[model samples]
Target: MAIHLVGLALLMGVIISIYLPMITQTAKILGSGPMANIPFFAIALVSSIVIAIASGSRTEQFQKVATLPLWLLTAGVMSAGMIIGSSFLIPRIGIGAFFVLLVSGQVLAGMVFGYFGLFGVPASALTVGKVLGALLVIAGVYLVTFK
Candidate 1:
């Protein structure tokens, strides 16, 4: 569990490092001008795919592990659909409202999953403090962007 957590943290750090500087450099090139920001997003997407493939290949049971998810393709498809849908919806809703709703929903779903031990996870307690912290994060997002 500790190794898995460390791997996840490292993955997140690498992705963020790639994304932040790529977007910043794109902004510099565009000079706050009229060019679209798609290139930076494209670079990030390609980099993420490459990283995923590399990491996936490194597992001891890489081939078998990759094939085991055939039964849950529906869930995977739905997740991808939601990601694409969010890209379309976020601009329409505005960032503040979108983030508030998104993060709150994630925390609610996570709490339920954790408490119930869904998806093979062990049952965990969800205290009032955890819920309050989630709400505080949502409130902070709203305060930052809801001018």
Candidate 2:
């Protein structure tokens, strides 16, 4: 299970690396704002539907979605906001700078969320090692984002 999770994480890294460039190009080509979501999400929706059908998962499971807290539903909104913001920023900042800044924010947020166990995250106390690692990452972010 751990091996599969590691593999999945590695795959996600590749996808995110490609995703930044692809979305940046798409935004440049479209010459439109958030409307770029139209084609991107259209493809995503179709791909997701096909995958869902192929996976043989039970559609009935989605019925439980309504039982979840309303705040949980906002995750979709957050995803859209992230994509849109990334599209707008990547071209101006350069992908390397943008990715580092994004990573920096995620690291900080991940630490806080894990520490407090907010939004379903498992509680984990902040340790000196984690703080040092985060500080190193933040310093890296500053170096990459600035001159």
Candidate 3:
């Protein structure tokens, strides 16, 4: 579990480094629109397909996908909105401020999602400690953005 967390963090850092520059460039060249996301999604889909094939779990994954609820499919929609929004906002706000705000929003949303057990995850009630941690995240974002 800890290794998975570390791996995910590393992957996220790499993706962010790649995404911020790429998306910002896309916005500059293409001007943010459905077209901007077209290449982004296309690349993501291709990459996913490649990874799925490389993992040799194509059949298992396809079976699992069939079992997944329709609501889970909305993740693509959410991802598109995030990517489009980031493409538009990062160019305007600067990556530092954009990431601070983005991370702050993610932290807050995660807390709420965990508290409510949204999307079928195990319920984890919001506690005082969690609230304090979230507040610190907001304070950190403010300090980074304003200071």
Q: List model 1 lDDT by residue over 1-147, tens digit each.
A: 699999998798576445444444545556531132456446657987689787766456645656776757677556444444444544466544655666667677888888999988788988889879877877776676574
Q: What is candidate 3's lDDT per residue for 1-147, written digit by digit as tens?
A: 699999999899779868866876886788665568888889889999899999886887777887878888999898888878877887677788888898888889888888889867777988999989998998999898888
Clashes of each: 0, 0, 0
Top lDDT: which candidate number? 2
User: What would the TM-scores of all predictions be?
Assistant: 0.52, 0.89, 0.83
lDDT winner, 2 or 3: 2
Task: TM-score winner between 2 and 3, please give it.
Answer: 2
- CA lDDT, every model vs. true structure: 0.62, 0.84, 0.83
Off by over 4 Å in 3: 1-4, 63-68
lDDT of 2 by residue, 23-105 (tens): 76787789864777778878988998788778888477557767988888888788777778888998889889988988788
By TM-score rank, best first, the candidates go 2, 3, 1
Ranking by lDDT: 2, 3, 1
Summing lDDT over every window of 10 consecutive residues in candidate 2, give the lowest-scoring window. 57-66
lDDT of 3 at 48: 90
